[model samples]
Target: MVAGVLEVDPAEVTDESGPETIPTWTSLRHLQLVVTLEEVYGLSFAFEEIRDVRSVGALRDVLRAKGTVPA
Candidate 1:
């Protein structure tokens, strides 16, 4: 899902994947990713929480905290 939003192959994404590491992860793409994640996980992210998510691992942590993903 993160790779899809970044318009990259899933094989290219990892727990460290993020805008800082992915050139294609522009601001627009970031928003798209946020929206996609929210919809898929059925959870909304607060602005501060979104800002805190810096990588796939961080995103998973947030989802886990929300009970959207099992720990």
Candidate 2:
């Protein structure tokens, strides 16, 4: 899911298990990821909220807050 959102290889996300922890995840990738996540989850995020997401886990938390992902 993270790889799809970032338009990167899925293997790139294999080792990622925390918030904003993926080393390859950059600011630009973050934007792309937020957009992709919104589309996939059918939810939107405020700029601040998006900026605040620092890891995959954090992203999951955000989605959970928006009722996009099951907790």
**Candidate No. with top lDDT:** 1
Kindly report which residue pairs in candidate 1 clash with one another: none
Q: Could you tell me the lDDT of residue 5 within candidate 2?
A: 58
lDDT for every model?
A: 0.84, 0.73
Report the C-alpha lDDT of model 2 over 1-71, residue by residue, as the tens digit.
Answer: 68765656766554344334565677887888889889878889998998777777778888888977533
Q: Per-residue CA lDDT of candidate 1, range 1-71, in tens?
A: 88878989988888888888889988788888888989987889999987777888888888888887633
Q: Model 1, stretches more than 4 Å misplaced?
A: none
Q: Against the true structure, candidate 2 has what lDDT?
A: 0.73
Question: After superposition, which runs of candidate 2 have C-alpha atoms over 4 Å from their true positions?
Answer: 7-21
